[model samples]
Target: MLLNGRNAVVYGGGGSIGGAAARAFAREGARVFLAGRHPEPLQAVAEQIRSAGGLAETALLDALNQQAVNEHADDVASSAGSLDISLNVIQHGDVQGTPMSAMYLEDYLRPVSTAVQTTFITAQAAARHMMEQKSGVILAFGGSGTQEPGQYLGGLITAFEAIEAMRRQLAVELGPYGIRVVTLRSGGIPESLPSDMEGREEIAGAIQAATMLKRAATLEDVGNAAAFAASDMAASITAATINISAGALIDW
Candidate 1:
């Protein structure tokens, strides 16, 4: 119940990571607002939460739409009395596994552009309410770090780095209002990959092998970390990246 009485808004709440975080938030006594472009998945997560006796709601939303994002934030704050947490987990449309030289410029830049746009819109919308209440937590997925040579991740790494930069800037600007901004960096989550994804086993193996613990982060790990990071127990933690990679990412 670390987040008791809090209100958390999660973009892309239908996705694996988002849904996990939403459930965790609700379990900790937060009223979770699941927002995404799809209704079915969002509703599925909401129903699960409600079945568990947790407060949950769903909204069909395009995180890319600034006006829509703003309106939604206003509505949530108006109804909930405060916006305590905001997390953007929207897909960035990244085309990985293709070498930059062979990739189209749009494909190379799509993730970078989409990541920044959706994050900015959602964070901005939440910030307005957070600033008013003088307290909030803006959570972001992904973080910048070393990548293996020839990984051919396209702009995925670049997109993550861009988000880290933005997170730092936001944390600095929003610090005065007691709003904390943090990013969760993971090596990889095998459960997040589709069962039929190409080279799925190899990819998961590589991810596990890269970590010192020989295990990639799990959806549950992410949920637990997210709940802690969003809670008052982490009030002193901000402008930082929480490494949940289990040694997959080594920081100096």
Candidate 2:
């Protein structure tokens, strides 16, 4: 019940991680607003939360639309008295598995561009509301990438880096207003995404073996972190980043 009576807006509430976070937030006593392009999935998550006697609602939206995002933020704040948390996990499918050299420039950078634009707009909309109330938490996601030559993960790495930077800057700018911006960076999550011909067990094992803890991050791990970030437990935590990659990071 860390988030009792709070109001939370989840931009990609239809996806696996987003849906998990939405449910977790609601379970903690927050009135959750699930927004996404897909109506059915968002509705399903809302229904589940409500069935559990939690406050949950669904909103059909294209997150990239700044005007719509702003309007939605206003509507939520109006209904809840004040917005407490905003998490953007919108999808931007511009990442093609091609390297910069051979990959068409258009396809190579599209995901980065789209993600930056949508996430920025959505965060800005929420920040404005949070600023008015002088309180809120903003959450975003990050990922890991292999550095092998020709491994080419498309532009996902670039996009994630940008997202991290944005979160840090937003944290600084919104700090005085009581809005905290942070990111939950993690390695591959297997609960929803299954492995392919490379072999599910092998790939998962390899990922675990590469991590310092000899294990991959779990959805529950992220959901818990997100809950804390949106709670008063993290009141003193802001302008910070938590790497939930199982120690799969090495800065050079």
Candidate 3:
């Protein structure tokens, strides 16, 4: 019951990571508002949470739509009495597995722009409400790259670094209002891969072997980590990136 009586807004709540985190938030007592571009998948996650005896709701909207984001956030706050947690997990449409030298400029820059815009829009909407209440938690996700910058990640690493920088600045600005901004970094999760994806086994193996734990992080691990970070248990953790990569990111 870490989030009892709290309200959480999760953007991209229809996807694997977002759905998992939404369920975890509801399980721990937060009323979760799942917002994303697709209603079908969002409702699916909402059904799962409701079936588990938890409260959940869904809102279909593009994360890139600033006005829609602001309206939905306002509705949530007005209805629920507070906006306690905000997690932006939208897919940045990144094209990875390609070397930067040969990548298209659009491909290399898409994620950087999208990730920053969506994160800022959603976080700012939540921060406004959080500031009024004098407390809140803002969560973000990033690739965090390899130990020494290996190959094939393309603009994904840059996007993550940009997000990390934004998280630090947000923490500094929101600290006086009792709001915490944190980013979770992981090497990669095998469970999040599409079922019919090519080289699934090989990719999973590589990620597992790369990690010190000899296993890739799971959707459940990400969800649980998010719950902890959003809870008061991690009150002192802010303006920082929490490494859940199992040693995949050496500096962690």
The number of the candidate with the highest lDDT is 1
User: RMSD in angstroms, all models?
Assistant: 0.7, 2.3, 1.3
| Position 89, candidate 2: lDDT | 83
lDDT, residue 12, candidate 3: 94
lDDT by residue (1-252, candidate 3, tens digit) is 999999999999999999999999999999999999888999999999999999999998899999999999999999999999999999999887778898999999999999999989999999999999999999999745653345477778889888888998899999999999998888888898888977788778888889887877899999999999999999899988778888777782
Task: Using TM-score, give the best candidate's number.
Answer: 1
User: Relative to the true structure, how large is the alpha-carbon lDDT of every model?
Assistant: 0.95, 0.82, 0.91
Clashing pairs in 1: none
State the lDDT of candidate 1 residue by residue for 105-182, as single tens digits.
999999999999998999999999999999999999999877887678999999999999999999999999999999
Runs of candidate 1 exceeding 4 Å displacement: none
TM-score of candidate 2 versus the correct structure, residues matched by position = 0.91
lDDT of 2 by residue, 1-252 (tens): 899989999999988889888988988999999999999999898998999999988889999888888999999988889888999887767544467778777776787888789879988988888898899899888744455454466887888877877877888899999888877877666664534534557556655766888778888887888898889998888877667778776444
- What's the CA error at residue 98 for candidate 1, in Å? 0.6
TM-score of each: 0.99, 0.91, 0.97
Worst 10 residues of 1 by lDDT: 144-153
